[model samples]
Target: MWTKRYSEILLMTFMSITCTRAESEFELRDVTLHIIPANTVERNSELNLTCEVNVVSRGGNTPDLKISIFKNYNNHNPVYINNTRSNKVTYTIAKAQASHSGIYQCDVSAGNQHLYSSEENINVTGLQTPELRVDKLKVTEGEKVRVTCSAREESGVLEYTFKNGLKVIYKESSSSGVVQRFHSLTSTETAKFSCSYSIHVGNGVLHSSVSNEVHVVVEELKFTAKITILPSTEVIEGDSVYITCDVEGINKNSSVLSLSKGSRLLPRNYSTVVLANDSGVYECRAKVNSAERNAYKNLTVKELFSTPVLTITPAEVFEKESFNVTCRSSKIASERIGHDDVKYFIYRSNKMISSDNGIYKTMAKNETNGNYTCTAQVNNTIKWSQWITFTAKVLVSKPTITVLNEVILNKPFRIECRSDRGSLPISYTLKQNHTTLSHVQVSNPSQKAVFTTSIQSIQQISEFKCEAQNNGVNSAQTSDTLRAQVTVPVGKPNLITVPVEQDITENQQLQFLCGIPEGASSPITFKWYKEKNLSPVYVTTVNFTNAEYTILSVEGSHSGSFYCAALNKAGKEEVSNHVNVSVRMARWKKGLITGVCLMLVTGIVFAFVIRYRAMRVKVASSNGAGIWSVRPPVLDSSEVVDVDEPEEPNVEYTEVLHPQNSDPARVPLRKGTDTVYSEVQSTSPEFHDEF
Candidate 1:
């Protein structure tokens, strides 16, 4: 058992070290964060925070980054976040307020690695004016008035001050920059109240401008009426009631007295058993001609019971769960005069659905969801509670993150997050590893949430995922990691000829290769083109970078500016630099030169045959033992002949002659003569009549 444990420990340690080494190649480092205007940011001025970081990637491609600037709000959630491939990110606050002053730090994430910057607590030099609100603008002397002072959405260790007409009435410090204070009216006068707040900064304090004033009036009674209810202030329905009113310091003989309920009149010093409206305000009026004084009081009539309140036993309800809805009142007037007094009925959308005596039970489902209310009744009196609503929530299934298209480096691509089953208004968060890329809320259940993003490196493909939430709970359903194809655009093609200068002669092999040095997507298609031609001379697709085109018998027609275009499945194209291909000779010109050379060789060989025949005639003549002289032929002659010796013996050359019309130097010596000798001439015996 000890050996097994030791082996397991070794395996775990090895795995941990291997994981660390793998991530060591990628680093998020040199993280530094700062703000503009080094001293302080004046309120209502533009402020900027800059986060700069340096990263090392696992490979040659740059790693994707997530930079966030966080404040002490909502558990340090990011106030500004950016999904980028750049080294620096800047967040701007167009109008800095008191709330903008706080401790802030920056976080930089590269791949699976993270780094954080030191915190910077900045100070805003100015403050916002607090707003003062009063619950009662007019009140009697010694009556309590509620006053609330609030700053502009500011928090974190603030001091609030409340003043009553330039006198400090209350002061308090709280983390929430809002405070409520109650001030009792002291005298019969109109008083103006205002408030201000302060923030503690470095070695000093910053106070806000005084808020707008709220005026409160304290009224003192001079001549008023006293009212009393008989048979107790709390009374049962259909009971007799008594009300008495007395006015102070009134001249009874000159002034007429009037007692009224709402708009009806009653006799003064009334002592009567009465039946009246269920609820109304009673007032006493003393009128002396046109000078009249009045005082009013609101009298609340007693009901069989208070308004019913409908509540669910469990605050949260999900589909397929069971809960109860109960209705009850705080007080009941003892079931006045009925058998089933204070009976309860529950309603669903104003339609009575349950008469279960203030309680109902049902399963939480979509079919059972609606607005519900309950009522308590006795005789003709009824009290209905406010409506309570239930919309059953459904737990979201695991989300699926799909890459809508093949991911292209540094180009925006769409990722869709979808849950097969969930309620409407689902919240989806797209994430890269542990860092959030973006958030989307899908209110329409039929549609999926889509987010668009780009990455700098291909390694981030496996790190992308999404999470869905709608249950109003802490847990969220997450999708599997993204898996999709990746493509890098082909770089510029480098085209080169076998002959570096691209000059080649006819019948010489010429080869040109199109290649990319780096950053090419395979398999790549290479198309070779000549100058300004729409069609390609050679087309090929290959997995390797280079594609070669060879011409075994190069022709002059192949000469011109030539280049190649390269494109991959990624659909990005690049053209190579053009190379001028100059062939020395054309096809027809070479054929013509060859024909002329063949004719020249044939003429030389024919001349040699004629000379051999002339030499045979000469040898026969020499055997005849004498030397013979040749004579020129006459002008305008068809043919010329030459004798081999002085004694003409052979029949092949009958005579040797020269042209008499031409000088000897001007005459042909061996060929091309106006008159020619036999032997080296076209007019020899070997010559046919075809000449």
Candidate 2:
């Protein structure tokens, strides 16, 4: 029995050994391993992977498989892996990073028998947060701008938040993308922004890093302005100019002010004082620190005008005479108005007389003969406050006269005429014995006239008158009457001697004689006077045929009045005439013969000298003499001769003895002889002659 039991144990043991060999061969198959993500993982993100092993046994029992995960198969140790043999095994990672990505493999074996094995890649993809970007790096005040955020994965929606410090100013969420725009934003409103994404990450939302801070600046408001004047369109002197400043987009509290002529800053209180003399453009500017807050207004200062006053002197009325009219005004302060700046316009009889400097004067009279009135304009405004009027009347003047004498029928008489003085274009009329004698016209009126008439006989007294008239009115008149008396003589008297020069030479005698034919008037008286003095020098009465009177050796003291008087039956008549005489030495008698002799001798000698000089010149000219020809001949050709050459020769000289006797019939005299010689010079030498 022992032998038989040993044999069966040997057989069973061989069978068990064969079965174990089959199981080992089955476990020798390769293990198949795989991971959920086979390529990449995001930094600090979960890496979930499931590793599996698929084995097919060759002959014996199924093999146990071992699997592990590593970062790099050539570098780092396994982070997590499953080694137990199952159909497949799962690996869960809380966070996966670059360190969690590597190669993975599973090993399958039965005891010492080898099984199938496989390898896979664990990628560990990275999950990144969405990033925000801005179109502009910075923002200015009142500027419109935008911000954008995006993700490379395109797996979820993104939301953006813009903040200034701790305050959020802008927020936008969009599933399409994270791009937001902010329009018309103040600089203080925008600062920092961040982008958040709605993605699957361990059960919570993820946000990206904030973008670079965006800065914004705010600017001040701007303004514009203009200025204008009211009422009158033109800016004139002395006129009140209403100034208004129009301003837009400027602060209300700020004022518009004018600069004082040359200043750059605004004046105090932003107001300007207007003066009549001040004229220029004025500007108003708003006072603000911002460039946009400043504005300007232009104000123009116009010149002021004044009215002038006109006054007439001498009451404006005159009797055909001249008078003066003057204009006056109160002095204007130069600071308020310039001297001579006011213009004066004088209106008279609808005529305008202009004076820029304002002081005017004029003369008025009846001769002026015009209606006069004046008006003044100040600052372009007409002034009628001052006016004047006047009238002139005809003026009378003195009278003048002209004297006349006439002789008729052996009798002498006088007449007078009158004229008006200082009168123009005067007329005159004369009357005698209640009858008009003559009428005369005069350019200037005068009261004076003269007339003379001879009276031989008269039957009655005669009257004469003269009158001067001006402007159709009688201005002056005068009249005179004279009685006439006559006596007849027996015969005409013979005047043997009449008193001549009453002023006789000293120590000289004067004589007078009278004669009458038979049957003449009985007694005739004669008298003598000097220059018609009050007293006569001599008087006598004679009725004879011859009468004579003589005063011997009369002196200057004997000179007196003289006259002749005849008395007969009717009335006595006297004739008196003035005489004047003077004594002086006679110039011709003083040196009569001596003066004649001197004049005669001087004239003869002058004529002779002139004749001699003219003859010498005639002779020299006839001979064609040069300066050298007039000079004395030299002893030898080399001898010096002091000769002044004549400028030119007289071509048509007369061969007369003297220029004073330069008649063509005269002949030229030789140098040393009184005989006349005539010779004509020919161009041929054969015609030469010596004289």
Best by lDDT: 1
Structural similarity to truth (TM-score) of each candidate = 0.39, 0.21
CA lDDT of each prediction against the hidden true structure: 0.76, 0.49
TM-score of 1: 0.39
> lDDT tens digits, residues 599-665, model 2?
9987886787557445454433545532122223369864432234432322233332222323344
List, residue by residue over 1-691, the lDDT tens digit for candidate 1: 9999999999999999999887687676589987886527777778889999877667745567888998853325788989988889999888776667778888887766788888888777667778999999998655679999987456557899899887899999987767899887756788799998888754567778899999999876344456666765556655566777666655667556777876677776554432223566777776543345676766556665677789987887778889898988777667565434668899987888888488899999987789999987766657788998877778788999888887888788899999888777789999988898888989975676889998887788899989998876564898899988888888888999997766788888899989987766688999999999999999999998899999899987888999999998778778999999999885678899999998998787679756755554332233322213332334754333333324333333324232223223322223222233332222333333322
Measured on C-alpha atoms, candidate 1 has an lDDT of 0.76
> Which candidate wins on TM-score?
1
